[model samples]
Target: MELSLSQCSKLTWTLNVHFIVLDCPGTASEQAGKSESCQGCPNQQLCASGATKAPDPAIAEIGAKLSSVKHKILVLSGKGGVGKSTFSAHLAHALASDNTKEVALLDVDICGPSIPRIMGLEGEQVRHAQKRSKPFYVDDNLAVMSIGFLLSSPDDAVIWRGPKKNGMIKQFLRDVDWGELDYLIMDTPPGTSDEHLSVVQYLSSTHVDGAVIITTPQEVSLQDVRKEIRFCQKVKLPIIGVVENMSGFVCPKCKNTSQIFPPTSGGAEKMCADLGLPLLGRVPLDPRIARSCDEGRSFLCEVPDSPAAKAYQTIVQSIQDYCSNRATEVQRAT
Candidate 1:
């Protein structure tokens, strides 16, 4: 019997198969049934038949469409309110600041699409001409695409299921004409869900630079981040690094620094050390950052001399360095 998603979840539960199955040879892999980890799995036979391994035609189509994009970076967070979208917006802005580089921002957080508002393109709608959709431009170099642009009202809700969400993501990847881009930053919804899997699967044929995981200093946030790391590992996606947002707060008047979230367990630095990951940089809580985001302005430009801005620049530079090194390695290999 073909099991539904719910059924598969229940079976995983019954078999005590943790969602973070570290050794799981993905169902689409050739070792699906042959691997020791698949021995007692309920869907072992079905996966072994190679039925689920059939590559989606859209994957190739997407790869072709995004061939001109030099680097594809996914901004992910295990929980919301970690400034993942903010980081994505700034990353695009920073890259486009070069003027010579073209940058694109794609928001895949369908249900809770905030990129439109965050990027100050809330009232903007995607223009369709000759059956092709064009992303909205923030400037000459920065372009953005999000489901938020499709809705008639910013107050509208996108009540969609897994299949619908997946289809929409496919359209975004395949239909949108990004032209040539130096970087394509995708801001995804929190957690390891259908959207995450869909994007990863669709971009499988493309050379994805990697993912930048965002998190706060709190242990609660770190716990979910660990699961997210495992999800990336299981999917075989490279992790660029981890960013600790709202790391601390510096009082303007007193020049005193305070641990706002309080990294109960040594925060992202300790976590990164433990996991062998890089701690990109810690962004301090700045009221101006929030104000700038709310007003649809670039915080880096708004407060160029602030420590938070410096931290962002440092982190963005680190990401650029990583992408440059990756490109060099690819070129050498080729």
Candidate 2:
């Protein structure tokens, strides 16, 4: 029996275990509507509510595509305005600044694509080659991509639903031509949304090296960060560690550091201790860091001797150590 997409509704198994192919929701969903098998799924609520879906990611395709990339790191924050994106940009910049390693920065923050602006590639567009889009090269060692590059203007808004967002992220992972790279740093939007879930699903085969969570010193921010940590735990994503951004304000004239947010008594340090996670480093609140970001300049280059720059270097070193150790472990297993 032949059926069109309109005619096919439920996904069922016939006698003798014959598979009945129906028009899927285009994603792996366990909703108890068209598919009879879905009715018996334990995670029906998770699928039906559209909170998260277990999509059948193209593992082989993604793995082949990202085979050359040595490491894939995701920068995330449960709360907004924790400087996740800024940290991502600088981290990539710092890595690429090494001159020996190749780095790629991918901005998956669909609604608010700021990497193009932050990286000073606002007007740059993604070029195509053999059907695969090429990432914008910031330098010989650095490349970047963002939905901002696809937009007509930086001010243009991306009003998309969850499925659309997921599709775009999938395209980024599958279609973008990111040759060999030392690191592919993804700057995700605030909170665990469709983008975060999609990235994890698609790259499950390619392997996400780990996640670096960013947070401020205030209790309001730390409280939300706790949720971010839990999200990683639930998803089984190994967290590299926590970074305490804006930990203190460095005085420009006197070369002094002050506790601006006042660490909420225990703050990030104590929180990390309680969670048994490493505190990578503390990034001080510096006006120059903001100025460098706004001007599309590399903060490390502008203020190599600054305390914040030194902190970033320390954090980057810790990340390198983590990646190197993981690589060694994989080799031993093989």
Candidate 3:
């Protein structure tokens, strides 16, 4: 059983080729071929040649395209059905309410883009011009873009792989004419997937204000949120704060409050405390909120006096403060 080092290496590679392929250092990675896992991979030689290491010129192009955008914010969630898109829509609406600020909302959830429906632009299509494609404008100041608009029908499925999804996101950033936005809010899909990676990479040269993570009160949502937080940290993206959605439900008849999704393990507040993160105000579960979204209307305008609306106003104020403070610091540094 005493084998030479070369024999041992060959045996290891042979035994782990499948696993190594699954987790290969990408061809663009500097460690692509040098890593031990690349011993028997098919792309080893090509990767080792350093051909794929060339930087994509699109990153710079996207940065320049979005230079007119002042604050870029990504709204993310750990899991689906957590109202990530709803928050994104409302955030854009609230920001544009001032009429002085121009806001753009870009939905990069390629697989299940709900922004079009939620934003009342369901059947809208992107208009191509001489150079840049124009996004559908919700109003004079608010513009919206989503893969939903490209689909012939809302029911059509986008069964694209990672590469295609990444390409679409790149086009959204580089091709769309956002045109001097005060804020560009990207409504990202759940989890740290290809879409998330593409947006972060494409905006690397740009100054991203931060991300607003949305979560429910239950422990299940909190668990996934921890992973999201780690992803943001690894990517060096700033965390503006965490918003606890559906924290509780209030009775319209009696004005009593009840925990709809009970925070079994102390919810986002406890989680934020443990992680030293800011706990953005919690939004109560309001049936009217769902109705407004279904009807493609703004809940803030519909129920401005409701507790949920008030909570949103507070959270949005916090975000505005954060962005203003960040801009001040950047100015000082410059």
**Candidate of highest TM-score:** 3
Better model by TM-score, 1 or 2?
Answer: 1
Instruction: Estimate the TM-score for candidate 2.
Output: 0.83
lDDT (Cα, tens digit) per residue for candidate 2, span 1-334: 9876445665333321231223224235444333544444444455576555544546568888999999999999998888988999999998898899999999999998878877988687754434347888889999998888888776788999988998888888888899999999999998876888888888887877999999999998998899889879877999999999998886878978788888875888999999999999999999998888888888999989988899999999999999999999999999
TM-score of each: 0.88, 0.83, 0.90
Q: Which stretches of candidate 2 lie over 4 Å from their true place?
A: 1-57, 127-132, 254-256
Error of 3 at 313 (Å): 0.6
| Candidates 2 and 3 compared by lDDT, better number | 3
Which of the two candidates, 1 or 3, achieves a greater TM-score against the reference? 3
Which tens-of-lDDT digit does each residue in 199-298 have in candidate 3? 9999998999999999999998999989889889978999999999998998989989999899999999999999999998899999999999988899
Which candidate do you rate higher for lDDT, 1 or 2? 1
lDDT of 1 by residue, 253-308 (tens): 99999998999999999999999999999999999999989888899988899999
Lowest lDDT sum, 10 consecutive residues, model 2, at 15-24
TM-score of 1: 0.88
C-alpha lDDT score of every prediction, in listed order: 0.90, 0.84, 0.90
State the local distance difference test value for candidate 1.
Answer: 0.90
